[model samples]
Target: MERRKFLKDVLKAGVGVTAGLTVGSALSFASQGKIELPLPYVKLDPKKVADRAYDGYYEHECAYGVFNAVIGELQRKVGGPYLGIPTLMFWYGGGGAAGWGTLCGTLNAAGAIFNLTCKQKDFKAMIDTLYEWYQTTPLPTYIPCKGNWCKQPFPKGVSHSPLCHVSVQRWCKNASVYFGRPILYNSKERSERCARLSATVAAKVVEMLNDYHFGNFKPHKVKGSQKTKMDCRLCHEVTMKELS
Candidate 1:
């Protein structure tokens, strides 16, 4: 009878231990303010941490407008005579409206934020520097067609490629450098992910901007051709070389 009673106590102790662990884990998550949502592309649910970076204006317009505002503020802080209006107009009119898909929108937004904080005059030059830094960092890789941004397959039967999240983090780092304050996220890991996405989008915008600024947009060479003969890739290569 004593042996049987001992066995019962052991089972109860095990159950208590398990219950304690579960409650502890749940409390930890609650303290972090993380809402676990199943994202389609990412293997893990991204923690929805509140950003404590800059307390600047957060607008609900399109990505381009947000980026432009960030860039404008950066230019103004850096002593640009006229608040980077020319650069903003150039990018907004050409890149945002045209929708060139080179850099991701998040990257563009981060770049703009960096520009405002750093007060840097040459946004393009800064972006190039950030890109070089990003090449050295380890990034998350996702199958191209499976993630939130991309759902459709390419023309051929090729599966999705790896999306670089490190680049976005680098952009955020640069922004932090310029802002002179740390933009704290829920955790360092979540901050890194958010930064990476933001930078990716921004990079796409930059690519489009470069194409519009330097590419030779002209009439098609083929007779009765509806499409223009301008080569965006060729133009970008040339512009990148110049920047280098």
Candidate 2:
């Protein structure tokens, strides 16, 4: 146990040093004041982004999976200062903020990337479209591992809400699997489903980024009346318009 603790401490120290170096590099560049927030982004291939995110899910779960996939690809393609980003910090977003199951981690990661690379004026609009897309689309449509990791038949479902628990419970219901506990949540089939979903989200984010990079991106506009079917809208219509 002592040895194990010592090794754990050593690992933590190493991680701290590495994180410090990366952040130091980024800050050094920042001190020059030559760079700005929402860093440079070149066009990235959606297919490659999907592939990386699919594999990344196994290593770091959902949020960091998508975050690292995009940022890591950026570092590979455009190495100037992209290497300085501390991508591992995104791991906290996994399991909907460490298992509380709040917002879907993939969407959270996508939003972060959009803010990181796109203009602030445009990022929220991009997030709006992406959230709506996630809410409506049948997910796990981009399966990278067909018969290999997912030997058993897996199912898909549409998540009407962007909350991770809701999205995952929807899939669990469709797949006829239990939705509680780590053992069931970490089941091979469900895990693979999320991996594919991460890939799908990552690919979509990359495509959107590519479009923005090339001046082809457009934000979706949903009419206020069509936003939801709840009766609260009757009382909140004016409030909604003000917010919008």
Models 1 onward score TM values of 0.24, 0.74
Candidate 2: tens digits of C-alpha lDDT, residues 29-133: 768876566887877888888999988888888998899999999876665457778888889888898889988899999988998898878888888888888
Tens-place lDDT per residue, model 1, 1-244, is: 4744564465547556645778888678768976332111101111111111111112221244435433443343332232324444333322223344344333445455444333234444545444433344443222122234245321111112111232333444554554556533333433334333333334433333334334532211121113422233433456656543
* Segments in model 1 whose C-alpha atoms lie over 4 Å from true places: 1-69, 75-80, 84-97, 105-126, 138-196, 199-244
Clashing residue pair totals per candidate (backbone < 3 A): 26, 0
Worst 10 residues of 1 by lDDT: 38-47
lDDT of each: 0.35, 0.79
